[model samples]
Target: MKCCFGFVTLFVCSASVQAQEANALVQQVKARLEKVADYQATAQMDINVPFINAPSSEVQVFYRRPDKFRVQKPQGISVLPKGGVRINLAALLAGNNYTVVDAGTAAVGGFNTRVVKLLPSDESGPVVLSTLYIDAAQPVIRKTTVVAREGGSYEMLFDYGRYTAWGLPDKVTFVFSAKEFKMPKGVTFDYEKSGPKKDPPKGDGKGRVVLTYKSYTINKGVPDAVFKD
Candidate 1:
């Protein structure tokens, strides 16, 4: 009986150690991101929706400073800047206003990871929820899932190869639900939805968007003119 009790005690201790290690991993990733000041990259966005015959691809030039970001997409459609407009997406959303709930563990990109869910305090805000899959072995973020209040859930996968130590991802892929996809015409009343529309194409319910960062010139004293149209 004593031997059996000892084994049970050992198991409980091991479990506790594992949990602490996972928490430490998350803290490491956050620390690395906090060190980054700015970065720039090229992004390829592919939006696939139901009733659309083909997926739409847009080439974007992205500039991120601490809490703010500028995304220049095709057709002059720009996203509104929020969260200080200088921080990276991860840091921006994980600010003091949001709450981070540890959602246990999961395997991402073959790496053992801990899932951290970020929920905004303001429910009426643009984003509903954001979850991050952080690699336990290294301080790198492997995947991200975002749910917009007005839009649907989006899953993003990051492939950190060349810039693994830099804490900046080399590639990112996006997958989203089709029901949330809306036609621009629906908003502008330019195009009308014909008869019964078919559901969007499904491929493992996953879509991908990859971003490649060429270079980052830090604190180069960028002039105000660069920000103007």
Candidate 2:
């Protein structure tokens, strides 16, 4: 009986240590992003939602230290999915309100990454669950899967380039569910937007948006007014 008790105690301690390791790794990644105070970038966005037909557009992306992020279109309507603009990793990894579980490891974008799942204690929040794939060598998040309470779940994959030094991705791709996608209230679509209607969505209820960045003006002090409605 004493031997069995010791075994159980050992297992519990090992799990605790694993959780601590995972949490520390996450904080390290967050610390890396903390280096960049602010940035503005010009990104060419490709929109491909099942129910919507819209042409690609050039948009301005802005981010300020802490939790401010916004995407702006040069002209015309915005096609971002509901709750889709929260792609800032620095903001997402902020605070210690969530429970982290060590979910083992996986390969993302040809790089081996450690997988960790974050579950928010406050269930009422928009995010239900988030899984992060962190490349420990680069110490950057290669992919993220977020399940939200409202506008449906989405997955984001990151590709690093020149801005890898700041732990920023040069490209980001989002794949989300179109079935629950909601437009802004009182918004309507014109059938003659750019071209003919897209074919009805297929069996997979997924939609995708790709943002390929042109350039980033980093740490240049973006004004608070840039984020205002």
Which is the leading candidate under lDDT? 2
Candidate 2 error regions (>4 Å):
76-85, 180-196, 200-205
TM-score of 1: 0.64
When summed lDDT is taken over every stretch of 10 residues in candidate 2, the lowest stretch is 183-192
Q: List TM-score per model, in order.
A: 0.64, 0.86
lDDT of 1: 0.57
List CA RMSD, all candidates.
6.0, 3.3
Error of 1 at 159 (Å): 0.6
Tens digit of lDDT per residue, candidate 1, span 1-229? Answer: 9999999999999877766665566567767776655555555544344544333344444444444455555665553333211124445444557666668889986888788776788878766777778886777878887666654555667777766766776665545554444422111111124234446557664333334554454433444333455
lDDT at position 94, candidate 1 = 45
**What is the number of residue pairs that collide in model 1?**
10
- What lDDT is reached at residue 1 by model 1? 100
Q: Where in model 1 is the C-alpha error above 4 Å?
A: 1-24, 43-60, 73-88, 91-94, 180-199, 205-208, 218-229
lDDT of each: 0.57, 0.79
Model 2's alpha-carbon lDDT is 0.79
